[model samples]
Target: MTSTVEVSPAARRSAELEDEITADPSRFRILTGDRPTGPLHLGHYFGTLHNRVRLQRRGVELGLVIADYQVLTDRDVADDLETHVLGLVADYLAAGIDPDEAMIFTHSAVTALNQLMLPFLSLVTVPELQRNPTVKEEIGHSRQAGVSGLMFTYPAHQAADILFCKANLVPVGADQLPHLEVTRLIARRFNDRHGPVFGEPEALLSSAPLLLGTDGTKMSKSRGNAITLGTTAEETARLIRGAKTDAHRHITYEPGTRPEVASLVLLAALCEDRDPGEVAAEVGSGGAAALKARVTEAVNGAFAPLRARRAELAADPGYLRSVLRAGNARATELAEATLAQVREVMGTRY
Candidate 1:
């Protein structure tokens, strides 16, 4: 028989933190980011981008990092690094991430943040790194025979990214809870050894439901199963048209028994901001074809505005570069101050 462990006090506290909304958004500083390996996708939109836009609108201090260096942990080729990074920026803009409201910077641009990662590396052990669920899953998915040192230590680097700006709220999904736990552990350990120089960041679980790929599997860029933000309306329709669906003649949202159809129904509901069951009922007796048509329509409708905005943004390459440069400068200013304090605390200021 298998055994289950009770949730730790810290984990329990982190879960509770998600519910406590800040009345004054300015008082809440959030650090959330994505690796610039590919363009943002529908999964990215519902999973994190939507919440980021909502939070930025709420007047929160937001720092968005384009983790360029982190992409090298698993892959060796970065032939189009600049293009991919700019694509991410354009996607962010199209998804309502205001450059003026949220600071968007690339990882390599912030040199001081990397310097802060050294001491953090010493705070965590290799076994602890191996134990992190997120790391383990990524390694397994990548099917790498051997994990790189960078891959092993990326979590520590992540801690530095969050602490550099002293962000107290990190928006993430439930599956990412372990990563946040590791970040909080690093913070507590550093404060205990050096001083209270970092805030123990809390995880703000995303309210968005997990979105599956059209093939009824986890959405992934490597798998070519993602519906990218830059996907055109016609491409979106084509993808949905080819998506898997059961032979059952009636549409239903029973996830367990009808996952493929349920996935499409979920996507439709999210796109239309309607209940999944309600959407399923509306598509009654119309069968797989009916569900596909509705899903295609909903998805294309949602992407139309985003596609237009992204096109406009992509057409102005100079403006995107300037946004990244300005963000880099802003991030450097804040990161340097934090690094200086860290050096002083560790008596390495010389």
Candidate 2:
């Protein structure tokens, strides 16, 4: 007799949402974004940004947040916050994210949206917040401050970001599914107790394999392993040159046994739009040096257009500011409408 394996509720929901997104993506409103801590790297390009672009093109109403306020959750100061925020906008524009198509705004810019946090907090308990894996991981990274209040309630804030716009779809990697659980819980609890003021957002999971940094570890800017979009072509080559790889002369794309080498191969494959195994086979016996060379070439070629576009965007800071202004205006409009609904249900309109 064969025993049936159990599927997780999140997994089951994700599978169902995937079909909906494919069937009629236009029916979905997707809320997703990144923290404006620094420059977005290649890992982010493939992991989230690229997927956002695809979903937007598919007619999904996408609201991309800059998460500027969240930058302060772990860090003590965000002195160059403006630069990072604008830089994020430039990167989005460069990466083919049309401002006309997707509403991109910062956390601080949406006051009404932030106000949703108060009521949302009531829906979730402290114990439930502590149980969030993403929150735990983020807290682990920031040992300097121990744990900030914002950091502790991050999942709730994230839920507010989602529910404020009544977004039904959230594109997230497998690891981030835990964060969405908090959002779903808050939405459900609020609707049952207060009223249906928010939509229970489901995860639109990304199928991309985890892309490790050059050092065969997590990709991060601080660790100097990340190949950021702002990096020069020469810098990319230098970084790839120093990447950790096996001593095997013949290359093969087997991530389980050879993650480092497979990562490099994956980079090349992502750039050239080919299978990792095929790219690895083509570089047969060429070793790490050759693999790096091909990756460098492919990466430089692929990002050339984006780099050029980014430069044009950077030159016109006024245009960038206008884009932000428009996004902020749109975000405020949505938040105000949601806040009105929330007040009506909670009888707090007075």
Measured by TM-score, the strongest candidate is 2
- In the range 13-64, model 2's lDDT, one tens digit per residue, is 7888768878998899999988887888999898888888888887789999
Under the 3 Å rule for N, CA and C atoms, how many clashes does model 1 have?
A: 0
Would you estimate the TM-scores of all the predictions?
0.93, 0.95
lDDT string for model 1 (1-350, tens) is 99998976655765565445555666788998988888889988988899999888878888999998888775643667889899999999999988987889999999999998999989999899989886787788765678777777878988988999999999876778889888899999999999989988887766667678988898887778889998987888889888888878889899998888898999999999999999999998999888989998998887799899999999999999999999999999999999999888899967
Clashing residue pairs, backbone N/CA/C < 3 A, model 2: none
Best by lDDT: 2
Model 2 spans > 4 angstroms off:
1-16
Task: Please report, in order, the local distance difference test score of every candidate based on alpha carbons.
Answer: 0.87, 0.88
- TM-score, candidate 1, is 0.93
